[model samples]
Target chain A: MSDLQARGHEDWLDDVAVYALGAMPMQDAQRVRAHIAACEICRREYALLQPAVGALAESAEAFTPGNGPIVASPELKARIMRTVRPERPGAATVPQTDAPVRRSVAPRERPILWPVYLVAAACLAIALISSISDIMLSGQLKQSQAELAQLRSRTNALASALADRQAAISDVLAAGAKHYPVDNGEVVRSGSRLYIAMYDLAAPPRGHVYQAWTLPKGSKTMAPSLTFVPDAHGVAFVSLPAGAPETSAVAVSLEPEGGSKQPTTKPLIVVPLD
Target chain B: MTEDAVVLMERVRKRDADAFEALYDAYHRLAYGLAMRMLGDASTAEDVTQAVFVKVWSSPELFRTGNFGAWIARVTRNRALDVIRSRTVRAETDLPQALPESESVEDTAFARIDRELVRSALASLPDEQRRPIEMGFFEGVTHQEIARRTSTPLGTVKTRIRSGLRKLRAQLEMTVTT
Candidate 1:
């Protein structure tokens, strides 16, 4: 890399750490590691950096929820399956996966639809409440009630349909179905590769649009990998910003709130990375 | 892992009836356990756990693979996180109330030492650095959430967390070496 005693010492330590953590860019990382082999001070510094990274990982390995019991419903699965099934099938199939239970419940892999729905509900309520006063209510109530009765019948039919779903789900779960695990190597899986950054988003070449992107690791680079108009999840899962690794780093930038060639502001958060 | 429950997931993707039920039975307990871990309250865990699996059914395609157990775990975890996030918990903070039952004494002791040391080092950080780091890593506060709670500039919040990690590493390194 450089003569062992030659490089300036001030920036040298940061280099050692960047190397140790593998946080440095590839070429620079090679240079730092090469120097570490000969330089005792850097070597010692590298040793120190090791557990610090682990402790950070341990802390980051959640960094929340602590070492506590994850509360769960005794009959939640039945409830979920009930919600989906149209009719219960007579036959049950078996689910098999290479990984076991430990890989099953790591936190981030779960569907966010529940909370997202809750958020949507709150938003809907806000939207409805704001607009409710404008509704003309004279004879509408009576008419609405008639419709409500029909809806309830429909709901009942749906319930029966759902009940069949429940039975099928019950047959499938049957008290120990294997879970499908999405391992993002962290408690959260922000998915990888181009997801939301699809170019099909480039349509309607007209109005002022919004934008999105996969960001640089550790909030560095000040550039994004891809950009798009996100769906409700605020997901613009682009080709995982090329060199991005699974570390708690990333921030989403808002660009014209529709679409932009580059990041218009700093970012919303160190996304998917966080 | 061919529990009758596992089969439902296969059907679940293609919109099967019986397979979903079988899958539900197989991994329901673990999902509950995970909810318990994230949420702590039995009731809250229960609510979130049910919601997790239910969501699985409606949007089965979102679940990209056959790893139903892990998928459930991931889903369970996400549900628990949301429940914890939106609901303001009034916890009677019990710092290190007891040694976890499953851990051996030696492992626990070493863990405790590391935890304490980490805590001490964290405490030494400037408030700016400590807040984001603790919130992000310790409290699981997402970067957006931290910025919102603190009312700090967004970029500044990021810098503080990044710099905070650098400093935290530096200090912890010093302590162990000394």
Candidate 2:
């Protein structure tokens, strides 16, 4: 063995393992590539290791759908095609390879079944064209469906946003209307509708209704406004009778269901409406 | 070189769309399959696959005369490994499951058989050898990282990987020769 080969042979073989896996560091890879160029043994070993390293990647094929090949998306093709220029016939000259070109075979004589062959070829051309068209149309349909779904989702979002905005506007406009803040609640008078909004107002116990009452000035009997139960969130909206009562006080009291004509219990809230 | 592949590549160099399309049809699945295996996510695998093809389309000259399948696999693996390395996810033992089989036909008979052989070889590996090798190639984990993560000594990890590779090399070489 040459002195250089004797010294570097073992080390270079070790590097071959890393080289095969493409895991050799860039600096080391340069050294290894150079060594392989000079050493026939290293080159053969490196070449042999390549197929194995490649098989490591090829093994992944089994995990794919059907343990077989996957087709590229039509959109991907379209995108690639955008940047790809079709060869203008004879635009660029191809450099010849080292491999020898095989001689072209002589044309064979036509069989007696020329008509049948022609008919088969025509049928095949039609079938091939039809299949390609079908594939393109299917891809387009899927793209359209996806777009439609996205549009529908966006439309629904817009509708929800619109609803939220309208609700906010209603709240802002209600702020302008006469508002009477009662205990843990507020009475809002907008046009003929009187909205009672309560916060932290627990729902009445069983067999009870939260009754609204209007106590007119200088009146012994309290006039009933509305009756309803607050929701689980401890919030309720009740519309009182149309037309505001001047010189009166609004009140809420827990009463028996089918609300009492007059509040039979202590008022939970009372707000004066001048 | 396979005759069909040589023809397709020549046409691709000439920027022939039909030829390029034919090549894409033939190899996209295997490319995507390798990406999926490395990245462990279908959508990301798809992106990597697209990137690999785009790369090939952009630089058709990179393809050598022979070994089209091997070239595609190498490109796909490298790109997928890049994606995996960029991810914040640490390599773990729980690999992704294979997807449900699709009805698509095999692109070429040779690729199908080659894939089967590789899969068999991989499956035959012991867990110790397989795990480290996968982490190195698929997750782009360094030998040191694999050693640390698996609690194996650095030397042990290296030996296991080298030994595993030797076995694989023998199996693959036999397939090619015979």
lDDT of residue B134 for candidate 1: 50
lDDT of 2 by residue, A1-274 (tens): 7988575566557566665565554444444543443344665676566556655766776675564555446676576565564456666576666899877999998876668889999999999999999999999999999999999999999978655433432432332466666655567765544556664578788999899888766776688867898765455656566356553677889999889987788898877777
Those runs of model 1 whose alpha carbons end farther than 4 Å from true positions after fitting are A1-274, B2-7, B89-139, B142-178
Model 1: chain B TM-score vs. truth? Answer: 0.47
- Candidate 2 chain A TM is 0.37
- List model 1 lDDT by residue over A16-87, tens digit each: 543433233333443444344334455566555433433442222222256653323445555565577544
Output the number of the lDDT-best candidate: 2
Q: What CAPRI-style quality would you assign to candidate 1?
A: incorrect
Give the Cα error of residue A49 in candidate 2, in Å: 0.4
Chain B, TM-score, each prediction?
A: 0.47, 0.78
Query: Measured by C-alpha RMSD in angstroms, how accurate is candidate 2?
Result: 27.6
